[model samples]
Target: MKLNERSVAHYATSDSPADHTGFLRLWGGLGTPPTAGGAGRRCWFVLKGNLLFSFESPEGRAPLSLVVLEGCTVELAEAPVPEEFAFAIRFDAPGVRPYLLAADGPAAQEAWVKVLSRASFSYMRLVVRELESQLRDARQSLALHRRSPWKAGATGRSKPQASEHSSRLENGHSPSKDCSPGGSVEGRGSRLSGWASAEWELPGPASLLLGRGQSPVSPETSCFSTLHDWYGQEILELRRRWLQRAQGGRPARENKDRP
Candidate 1:
């Protein structure tokens, strides 16, 4: 494949931080068969984000070879000389011979293997996607935490009104008396008692099912069964109250006896 040799040369000389740079012994000249008996030539290798370049010397401005680290695997290999810390970059393409290289020591050999193995565009993309997902989740959690205080403040504001109504009921006063038309005091008291019994007598089963501080299921869930059951309970409670009023029985006496 044709490469932009001028751009490659410029990048080799650029001040960008190299992923890894060191002297590694090359087993053969680029595009040549390996020699069996010769000690390999040591060259300066620079790895820059999936591109491995070889230079004649550390100060060389030109790149002797460029190996694109894609569709390839780095594996520990036996070198021509015994005890040489050797590794090879083996490509999957047909008729392409593996590039044999030897690091100066065992530590360097392992480091080179690790860096080369991970030096692929696909691997970098995978890591980026994983990080993005984690960041999105973190942002969602922060938003929920931020909204919690506003919900608490709203609940706090409503409490005083509820307390005032409850105190009026306890003091034998009707909460709706101010707006209600004038009538006999006994008649007004009975009407207020009946109104409170129907409206505020029992807490809904949905609130009981969800304990304090727990949010109710969202309407957007499309959970029709739960919604039906909740409303069914409410219908049953209203029906029972209607039957009591029809029979001329007052539930106020029963409610007043409760703790």
Candidate 2:
């Protein structure tokens, strides 16, 4: 395949971090079979991302060869010269001869094999996609957690307001009439006091345990606890009114009846 020599030359000389770099013995010409009795040449090999570049020396600005480490496998191979630590990069393409290379030692051979095996664009893309999926799931979990308190507060407040309105209707009073000027000041004050009491009592353990500045929902005070407190307050108010009637004291209805 024809490569853009200018781009390849720029990348070869770029200061970008390399994945692996070392001097290795390269056998034969690029894509050609090994010669009958010729020894391999030791060249400076640099692996930057998926592109492998070989230079005449470590400081060489020009690259002698370029190998795209895609659709390829790196495996241990027996070199022509015995005692040489060798490996071959075999590509999947037809009529493409494998690139035979020998490292200086066993450690270098193993390291080159490991790095080359993972140096494909496909492998890097897979890693990126996995990380993105994990990030998305984390964001979703955080959004749900943030909305939980507001949802619970809305549900808790709605139930109490509905029950309060129903109780007023059963007692022969209109919600609109509660705001009228004809109502006694004492009655209005008492109603306001009840509302204040309920409002104060709504936060329950959140206020007591976490202090006034803390949020209304705490670990100790969940939606269940808030609903329980509201219902409990209603029961207490009903019992108090019943006791006042039994004692023959003036009930709140008498205030509306008076001039």
Best by TM-score: 1
| Candidate 2 accuracy as TM-score | 0.55
lDDT of 1 at 240: 70
Q: lDDT per prediction?
A: 0.61, 0.61
**lDDT per residue as tens, model 1, 20-134:** 9999988863674666675688899999998999999999979888998876766678789987888888776788888889999878887787677667654453344334334
Clashing pairs in 2: none
- State the lDDT of candidate 2 residue by residue for 1-259, as single tens digits: 6778998789788998888999999896495457566458889999998889999999998998898877676667878988888778876689888898999988888778767766765445334433433443464365456533233223434454455344323432221232132322231112222211211233422123235454322222235676477457545655665576578894575435443
User: How many pairs of residues collide in model 2?
Assistant: 0
Ten-residue region with minimum lDDT total, candidate 2:
187-196
List candidate 2 segments past 4 Å from native.
29-38, 147-259
Candidate 1, residue 136: the lDDT equals 37
- For model 2, what is the error of residue 71's alpha carbon versus the real structure, in angstroms, after optimal superposition? 0.9
